[model samples]
Target: MKLGIVRCAQTEEVCPGSKDFQALREKTGVFAKVDDAIELVGFTTCGGCPGKKAVFRAKSLVAAGADTIAFASCITKGTPIGYPCPFAKRMIAAVEGNVEEGVEVLDYTHGW
Candidate 1:
C-alpha cells in the first residue's frame, strides 16, 4: 500500500522525519503489522495550528495514489518531543471525513 505521512509543522524544524521514514521502509514499529510493501507517496505538515490544511493534504495524497494516510508520531504519539498536537484528534477526524471511503487513516506512523 502507498502511504502519506502528516506531521506537526512545529516539529518540522527539529525533526527531519528520517527515523519515521526509515521505520516505514524497514517495516518496523507501527508498520510491522502491515503485510504488503508500503510506499511513501507524500510527507508534509498540517500547515500549523488548527491544522485546517490536513483535509487538503490528505486529499492531495490520495489523489497522488496514497491509499493510507498516516499521522506522524510527532503529531499523534509525540515521540521525541513529548508533546503531541492538542488538535490532532480533530485534524485526523477532519481528514478521515474528507477523504474517500477506501482511503485508510492511521493514527500514527511509527512507534518510539
Candidate 2:
C-alpha cells in the first residue's frame, strides 16, 4: 500500500529540526517492506498554515496511489524539541474532510 506524508511547509534547510522525509522513507522501508503493506510514496508540506493547497495536494496523492496519509510525530506530539503548529490541527481536519474515501489517516503521535 502506498502512503503519503504531509508535513509542515518549512524547508528542511531552514527548519533544521524538521523531520527528515528521506529518513522516514528509509526507516519505513517502503521500497523493501512486505508487499501489499502500507508504504510512503510521496511527501509535501501543508503550505504553511492558512494555505488551502494542502487539501488538494493530499487528495491528489491519494488519487495517485497513496493508500494512507500520515503526519509526523513531532507535528502531532508537541515534543520539547519540536512544537506543533496550530495549523496542524486544521490541516488534519481538512485532509480528513476532503481526501479520498477509504484512505487511512495515521497520526503517529501520542493518543492518536
Candidate 3:
C-alpha cells in the first residue's frame, strides 16, 4: 500500500519525525496489522492553521500514487512531547474531501 504522511508543522523543529518514519518502516501500529507492505509516497505538513494547504497536498500525494493518507502520530496522537495539532480534524476532513474514492485516510500512522 502506498501511503502519504501528514505531520504537525509546530513539532517540526522539536521532532524530526524519525520515529514515525521508523515505525512506518517497521510496520508498527496499524501498518503492522495490514497485509500489504506499506510504501511511503510523500511526507508533508498541514500548511499551518486552518489547514487549507493540506487539501492540495493530499491531492498531490494521491496524484503521486498514494493510496492511503496517514496523519502522523505527532498530529493525532501527540507522541514524544504530547502536543497534538489543534486543527487535525479539520485538516483530515479537507484531505478526505479532496482525495478520490477508495483512498484510505488514516487518523494515525503510529501509536503513542
Candidate 4:
C-alpha cells in the first residue's frame, strides 16, 4: 500500500513525526493492518487549523500515487499537543469525498 501522511501544521514545529515514521517502518499502529508492502508516497500538512487545504492536498497525494491517505497522529491523536484537531471529522469527510472510491482513508498514522 502506498501511503500519504497529512500532519498538523502546528504540530510540525514541535514534532518531527518520528513516531509516525517509526510506526510505518515497524508496521505498528495503523500500518500493522496494511498487509501489502507500504510505500511512503507523501508526507505533508493539513494547511494549519481548520485544514482548509486538506482536500486539495489529499487529491494531490492520490494523484501522486498514494492508494491511501493517512492522517498523522498529530491530527487525530494530537500527540505532543494533547489536543486533536477540532475539524478532523469534517476535514476527513471532505477528503473522502474528494478521493475516488476504494482509496482508503486512515484516521491516524500512529497512536501514542
Candidate 5:
C-alpha cells in the first residue's frame, strides 16, 4: 500500500514523527492492517488551525500516488503535544468527503 501521512502543523517543531515512522516500519498501529509492504508516498502537515487546507493536502497526497492517507497521532491522539486538534473530526470528514473514490482515509497512524 502507498501511504500518506498528515501530521499536526503545530507539533512539527517539537516532534519529528519518529514514532509514526517507527510504527510504519514495524507494521504496528494502523499500518498493521496493510497486507503488503507500505511505501511512504507523502508526509505533510495540515495547514494550521481549523485545518482549512486539509482536504487540499490530502488530495495532493492522493495525486502523488498515495492510495491511503492517515492522519498522524499528533493530530488525533495528541502524541508529544498532548493536545488533540479541535477541528480533527471536521478536517477528517472534509478530506474524506473530498478525496477521490476508493481512497482510504484513516483517522490515525498510531493511536486511538
Candidate 6:
C-alpha cells in the first residue's frame, strides 16, 4: 500500500517540533514498520486554511499510486496547537467522499 502524507504549510521558519511529518516518519519508522506493504510515495501540504486544492492534490497522489492517505499527527491529532485544522478535516472529508472508493484515509492522531 503506497501511502501519502500531507502536512501543514509553514511560512514562518522556526525550530521545528515533533509535529513535523518527516521527523515523525523517522522516529516512528512508519514506512519500515509497514515494509513492502506500504511506501511513502507522496508528500505535500494542504495549502493552509480553506484547503481549496487539497482534494486535487490528494487525488493526484492517489493517481500517482498512493493507496492510502495520511495526515500528520500535528494536523489531525491537534498536538501542540491544541486544535485541529478545520481545513484538514474538510480535506479529509473531501478526499474520503470524492477520491477512489477503496483508498484508505488515515488520521495519525489520538484523543479524537
Predicted model with the maximum lDDT: 5
* TM-score of each prediction: 0.96, 0.68, 0.91, 0.96, 0.96, 0.70
Listed per model in order, the count of residue pairs whose N, CA or C atoms clash below 3 Å is 0, 1, 0, 0, 0, 0
Global lDDT scores for all candidate models: 0.91, 0.62, 0.84, 0.91, 0.91, 0.65
Residue-wise lDDT of candidate 3 within 1-112, one digit each (tens)?
9999888877888888887788788888768787788889999988777577888888888999999998888888877679777888888987888789999999987775
For candidate 1, the C-alpha RMSD (Å) to the true structure equals 0.9
Candidate 1 local lDDT, 5-93, one digit each (tens) = 98889899999998889889898877988999898999999999989999998899999999999999999988778999999999999
List residue ranges in candidate 5 displaced over 4 A.
none
Better by TM-score, candidate 5 or 2: 5
lDDT of 6 by residue, 27-46 (tens): 35333345444467877777
The digit string of per-residue lDDT tens for model 2 on 1-112 reads 6777766665333554334444443444223333554456777766665647778878878877897777655456643336666677777888899877788776642222
lDDT by residue (14-97, candidate 5, tens digit) is 999999999899998988878799999999999999899899999999999999999999998888878989999999999999
TM-score of 6: 0.70
lDDT of 4 by residue, 1-112 (tens): 9889988999999999899999999999999877778899899999988999999898889999999999998888889799999999998999998898999999998768
